[model samples]
Target chain A: MTRCRFWRLDRHPEGNTDFARFLSLQEEDCAPLADGEVRIATEWLSMDAGTRMWMSPRTDGYQPPLPLGSKMVGLVLGRVIESADAGYPVGALVRGFGQWADVATVVPALTGLEVVDETVADPRQHFGALGMNAWTAYVGVKEVASVKPGEWLVVSAAAGATGSLACQVGRNLGAKVVGIAGGADKCRYLTEEVGVDMAIDYRNEDVDARLAEVPGGVNAFFDNVGGPILDAVLGNMAHYGRVAVCGMVAGYDTDAPMPGPAKFDQVLMRRLRIEGFFIPDFLHRGAEFMPQLREWLDAGKLAVRFDETAGLENVLTAYERMLTGKNIGKVVVKL
Target chain B: MTRCRFWRLDRHPEGNTDFARFLSLQEEDCAPLADGEVRIATEWLSMDAGTRMWMSPRTDGYQPPLPLGSKMVGLVLGRVIESADAGYPVGALVRGFGQWADVATVVPALTGLEVVDETVADPRQHFGALGMNAWTAYVGVKEVASVKPGEWLVVSAAAGATGSLACQVGRNLGAKVVGIAGGADKCRYLTEEVGVDMAIDYRNEDVDARLAEVPGGVNAFFDNVGGPILDAVLGNMAHYGRVAVCGMVAGYDTDAPMPGPAKFDQVLMRRLRIEGFFIPDFLHRGAEFMPQLREWLDAGKLAVRFDETAGLENVLTAYERMLTGKNIGKVVVKL
Candidate 1:
């Protein structure tokens, strides 16, 4: 039996910052893989805001609250070392929802475990450019927001994984992009490295005032944070604007829901459309979305900056960074 | 010269109830029709919640605030007594946006003036089954909400003009309809007269608790009132549900915007779609909508209860009644 170390959720978290108090790192012997299950030798784990909601006791999330005393669940990218499933064979690179452990044992069908291409220059791209975040950015910006050429597209949490890719996706689709981020560094990265038309430092700048200056108002919004920033964007939306609600990281940490945006009346006032979508709901359409995502990635139009942290012991640190907007891009922990 | 009695805006009202303090009944001699203008001897004036929004000094509504001291504008159903436009000849019955006056002067193109079919059994049917409210109900139910057969549909303010029509439209399309309104009488009117499968008295019962009893959750929502009622409906919406925001009458009364529904997060949690639309944008498709509405009316499937109030001098009393939900169904003033 292989010895494995995993973070167990000891209690439901109150907010994003208190994860250490609710979770504990423990070592255990790996149990034999059940039939139709695959065991992955975890090499890296993607820290996402969604997992933070599952960690709370909130009953209103897309997925039910994670039961206490269970292994913390998150996106895992690694190789399948042992398998009882025919589809996920041994020696295959895989990515899906798996435990935060050195060896993650998961039911292939239940975990959405599937083999990933090994031909990509960087295996980490599985969690970056060609991953769930990219799929979300692609679907949200292209299909949901219905962005057209020369239209103004605004992205919130623009320095993060999905938002960064969404910015590039909007740009590649010929939309003029305005990225909203927390600090000068992320703002600079958005305008310089990410090639956005403009970057608003939300922490220092008045988001509402800046967005008000947008010519013809913002026609499309790809939103991750759904609190004050959402209100600011809603107030500045053009007539018949579309808002693709990708995430509400602002309310993920707490059990209580964040209050609805103050300017939500703008939805009716401007005759707008607001739609909420997640990547998992569109999993079946990954094949349809992949060709375009890959082409942009290969042509250097789509890029993701990795805010990497080493060791599973520091997963909490990396997660807090992502949740609190401390990191500039995708936050990942190397096992 | 013909004498004209019209309501003029003296000041913006603070709430739906205070119209008496802001508007005054005044008389003036009607001027000769200008080029492309048509004059209508107003027979009936449609009382609408939309005009209530225009009465506030709020600048955030779809249309600009109605300028103080201008004639109060409303829908007029009458005969064209004078015309400079060839399209609308004298003696033709017409309906369009015109002044709340005995003799309404209008530019045919600007006010959406169009001659009506005179053969219908009741001219009031033009303000009932074939009116703007019916068109709004049809578009909101069939196109915006996208209610499928056998699905549960919830309509707020179900005793109001548009809401009642929406409930019938949903039923006509084979959807299971649930109507929500404020009083027991309104609830009775919904279930008995409107033929809704279920009726919840929002003032007497817990809307959220009652909606929770829906077998498969509410699949579509035609919301006229947007406050706690909206929040209740949001909490009970099925996965991928659609909300057609026809009006936000709860906020229409005040200059300050109503806060968004407390369960706004449900949009993301349930993967819902919320869209806002008004009748004016769809005026061009009135011809396309008329045949089906006429069929329903002719077949006895469509009906509107007129809460008739006599005299243009009492227009405020009638308008206030409609705005405050004191009257059921279509409220109109006889000139």
Candidate 2:
């Protein structure tokens, strides 16, 4: 038996997560791996805004709410130390949806696990730029929004994981990208580093006024932060614009009912197309995504920055920071 | 010179349109027809909710706000009285965006004028079931929403022109249709006359509670009336649902800022797609729309109910009633 430490959901959260009250850290013994099973030592845990949604009492979301008294759900990068499964050889790195734990036993048939090649690219890149974030931005900009060259595309939360990638991808697709971020630093990162044509410091500047100054108006909006910003963007959208509804991190922490876009009339008046998507639905098109993303990464056309915290003990702080928009890029915790 | 009576935009309205203040009845001398022009005597004028949007001060809508002192723009069915053009012979019926006037001179090259064949279908039917209303519903449901058989489709304002047609069309596509309308009469009309599976009297019953009673949930939403009802429907939508935003008659009369759906977060959580569409953008597909609509009309699979008032002088009352949801089916003025 191997000793394992993991976080368990003690209760559903209200408003902002009270991590200590809703989650419990427990140490347990893992049974020896059966045939076709591998025991992995968790190395890094990816904390995303989506994780917060699972803790909410709302059951109508795409993914079901987390069950009370179960291991808190998350995606993790791990190394296979003990493997009875020939497919997952010992010393190989793997990635999958495993609980936030120091170690986990993965059954090949029962769960989805992908072997990672560290030599090709860093494993962390796979978790951020080269993985879910890139795939989401790719499918959203190329497939859903169908962004065209010279078209003005606006992206909210431009400094966040998916938004950052979407900004770069929109530029690669020949779109004139306008980014919206909270602070001066994130806004600067968006324009100077991420290569967006312009960045609005939403905390300082008026989003609607700034957007209205754009010459031809916003042809597409890639929304990550929903709320007043989303409403403001809706008001500035050009005729027949498209909106790719990615994430609403702004509303994830609120216990009170979040209000819809007040300017939703723009959706009707401008003939906008707003589509909400889940990345898992487009994983089948990974062949179409990974290659282009890899090429861009190699060409230096794309770059990823991580706001990483060391140790699983600090996961709560990292998560709280992410929910409060304190992190600049992808928020991750090393176990 | 022929004396012609027309309605002109006197000024932009503040709230519920003051017909006498914002609009003026003017007696004008009709100019003689040119070599390629035809003069038509207006018979039936289509008074739609879209006409009210043109009177608002908002300049960023799909159609521009009506310029002050111009004729109130509307679709009209008329008979050609004088013709210098061979294509538009005398006594032929025509339909186009002409003034709210008794007579209009149409130049075939400059303006779109469709010559209606009364023998094939009544000219008034051309304005209702076989005209813009049917086309709007067809494009929104078939092309935009892409509703499938057995899918539960909820249509707002099911007693209105486009909504009524959308209900019938959803049934034709094998969908279980639920309609939201005001008053018990309109609700009864939706279920019995329009062949909807269920009808929710929004005036009497709670839309969200009734929609929750639906077994499979709402697969698609054909939204014509946007307001609290639209927000309620958002909460009841099924996963991967589609919403076709056709109109917002509820907000058409308001000068005050309108609040959007309070439950719009459902748009992201449920992976829903909301598309706003204009009928004119799909007008090129008339070859695809007209034949099918004509067939439905011929087979009695579709029927049109017109809330018509006599005389152009009463156009103001009819327009007000249409905007306020006082009329059932298509509201028109028989000039």
Candidate 3:
């Protein structure tokens, strides 16, 4: 038996990801790998808004309530310590779905773990650039939206993990990219560092006014933060524009019921399409998405950034920081 | 010269479509029809929520307001008094893009005047069943939402022009149509007369409770009145549900600034697709839709209803009744 530490959602956080609500460290016995099972010691965990809705009561509480005293569900990088599964050899570095914990057990029934090499670049990018965030940005813009070169693209939270990747990827594909973030610093990072054509700090800038600068109008909008930002984007979308419903971190802790100014009118007026997707929804496309993303990263066509916190105890802090928009890139917890 | 009465957005109404505010009505000289021209003696006009949007001032105040004294745009039926265009001859009755006046002249380039026989069914249905309302309802459900037979289909404002048509069309297409209307009277008209599978008088019934009764959950939701009804539907939508954004009557009057609770999360959680569409946007399909609709009506497979108001001067009264939900089915002004 080996000691394994984990973090789980405590009660339901009211507004921000409540780090103080995290449970104290607990011990768990590592069971021997069962037939067709693999045992892994988690090295890194990715924190993002994609999993936020699963925590809400409205999601039919499908995902097990982040068990009161267990690690939260997230993506993690681990090394296979033991394997009863023939395909997964012991000592191979792999990534799979797990909690903010030090170790995870897996089987083929679940999405199989993929081995990644850290020496090539930062191993953490495997949890980011080559992982779900980048894949979401890639598949959403390229596949779901079927974005064409020369199309005008707008991305919300452009300084964040998925948005930054999407903007850079859109630019690489010959599409012009506009980024919207929270502050001047993040906006500057997006245009100057992430290589976006333009960046809008929504906090100070008017989205509609800035949109006019795009000439005709945005052909596609990759949204990460919903609410007013989504509304603004809808108002300026060109006829036949496509909107990929990325995330709605803006109203995560909101208790007030959302009312109707339901913007369906705009959707009709502009003949818009709003498609909601989670990376898992496109799991079947992994065979294609992974190889393509790997090439983009290896060729240095994509930029990767990550904010990592050491130890499982710091998981909740990382989550809080993410919700507060304190991190500029992907927020990950290192176990 | 012919006397014609037309309603303009005198000053966009605050809460209701005020007839007095419908700024213009006058006797105008008619020009002799040239090649490819058809002069129509207008007989019927339909009222809808879309007209309100065109009537109001743009928030940015950029585009000219739907020119203050121009004829309102809507579906209209008329008898051709003369035609220089070989396609339509004198005494031919048809329906097309006309106005609230007693007479209208249209160029062949823009006319979609479908010849109809009133003895077979009321010609008024040409503007209801085979007109913009029915076609809009059919396309919104069958095409954009891609509703499947045996799936749950819910429609808001289930008693109005488009709503009633959608309900019947959903039922005819093998869907269990659940309509959401404002009062018991409309609800009765929907289920008892219109053949909707079920009815929800949102004014008295609990939508969530009623939704729970429809065991299959909602596979497709054809939304007409957005806001709380839409929010409630979001929480109960089945996986891969499609929400057809037809109209949002809920937000037409409130003076509040337009920030609403974004159910953008709903789209992702259920893998939903919420698409908005304007009928004209799909005008290219009119060639196919109109013929198919006429065939359906001629075969007695579909039915249409209307609340008819006689006289062009009553246009304002008709518009008010439609806005207040006082009229069932299509509200048409007759000359």
Candidate 4:
């Protein structure tokens, strides 16, 4: 038997997640792997804002709420230590929904475990740029927004995981990408590192004013942070602009309902199309997208930024940091 | 030469149109028709909520603002009194954008005038069911929403010109239709006359609660009235639902900015797609839709309700009545 540590959801959060009170670290004994099962030693745990939404009492969403006393749900990249499954051999690196645990027993068929390619230069890239974030941005910009060349593409929360990748994707697709981020450093990183044409620091400048100055106005908006920022963007959208709503991170933690976009009339007046998407819906398109992403990665046309914390013990701290927009890119905990 | 009476925009309205103040009855002298020009004596003038939007001072939108001193823009069905154009012979009944006028000279090529079929029982039906209203409904329901059979469709302002047609179109496409109208009379007309599966009188019942009672929730929403009603429908939308935003009449008269949909998060949570479209954008599709519309009209599958006032001199009164929701169905001024 092996002792494994995992975080359990002790209670539903009222507003913002109170990690200490709502979640508890629990130790559980794991028996030897059964037939068609593999034991994984978790290495990297991805922290997502969506995790907070799952902690709410609401059951009427795209995903079901996490029941009380259950292991907190999350995605993990791990290496198989023991395997009774032929498909997942011992020492094979794999990625799947293993929750927040140091060790997890998974049946590849049940968990839909994916074996990571060993030849990839950086495995962490798979957790972000080559994984969910990049895939979401690709689907949004290419599939939903259908971003055209010379079109002004605006990305909200541009320093975050999905938004950062979306900026690069927009530029790669020949769009004039503008990034909206918090603080001076992140804005600088957006323009310099992410290679966006312009970066607006929401804390310092008026988003609507800056967007108004753009020559033709925003033709496509890839929104991650919803609320007032969405309204501001709506006011500046060009005629027939498209908005791909990837996430509404700004309102995720609020107990009170977030206000809707004030400039929503622009939706009718400008003939805009606002569509929301889930990453899981387009996972099948990965085969068509991954090769192009890999080529871009190999050719040095695309770059990824990782904001990693050293240990699983500090996952809560990292999560809080991510929620507050303290981290510049993908927030992950190394176990 | 013939004398023509028309409404000219004296100034832009501040809030709800003060028609008496901003619009003035002006008499103009019509010269003899030049080559390819036809002089039309107006019959029924269409009063649309969209006319108010053009009255605003804002120049940025899908259509340009109505300039001061120009005739107030509107659609009119008229008979050709005299014609220099061979295509539009004298005594032909035509429909085109002739502003609010009793007589006007138009070059058919420039104005895109269409000669109305003489076999039509009621010429008013052309304005309501077989013309722009029906076309708008068809494009929104079939082309934009792509409303599938057995799907639940919720239409706002469901007793209005476009909304009534949209409900019938949804039912015609084998969809389970629900209508949200303002009053009990309109609600009755929706269920009894329009043949909607359900009708909710927003003046009395809670739209969101009633929608929640529906088995699977709204799969497609055809919105003409936008504001609180749009928010309510958004809250009860099924996963991957589509909203075709044809108009936002609720906010069309407001002085201050109208509040957006409060339940907008459902757009992301339910993965909703909200797209705005104009009739002109899909005018090319009229060839595909008009034949089917004509068949439905002839087959008694579709019925039109005209809320008309006598004489073009009372056009402002009818326009005001349409704007205030006092008139149900298609509001037209009969000359």
Candidate whose TM-score is highest: 1
Q: What stretches of model 3 exceed 4 Å from their correct place?
A: A8-10, A32-36, A52-64, A115-122, A254-265, A309-317, A333-335, B2-9, B21-25, B31-37, B59-64, B84-89, B108-121, B253-264
Models 1 onward score TM values of 0.98, 0.94, 0.90, 0.94
Candidate 2 CAPRI level: medium
**TM-score, model 3 to reference:** 0.90
Most accurate candidate by lDDT: 1
Worst 10 residues of 3 chain A by lDDT: A57-66
**Best model number under DockQ:** 1
Q: Tens digit of lDDT per residue, candidate 4, span B225-253?
A: 88888888888888999999999888777
CAPRI rating of model 4? medium
DockQ of each: 0.81, 0.73, 0.39, 0.69
- Pitting candidate 1 against candidate 4, the one with the higher TM-score is 1
Which 10 successive residues of model 1 chain A have the least lDDT summed?
A279-288
TM-score of chain A of each: 0.98, 0.94, 0.92, 0.95
lDDT, residue A315, model 4: 79
Consecutive 10-residue window with the lowest summed lDDT within model 3 chain B: B56-65
DockQ computed for model 2 against the true two-chain complex using alpha carbons: 0.73
- A157, model 4: CA deviation in Å? 1.3
Order the candidates by TM-score, highest first: 1, 4, 2, 3
Ten-residue region with minimum lDDT total, candidate 2 chain B: B279-288
lDDT of 1 by residue, A168-205 (tens): 99999999999999999999999989999989999999
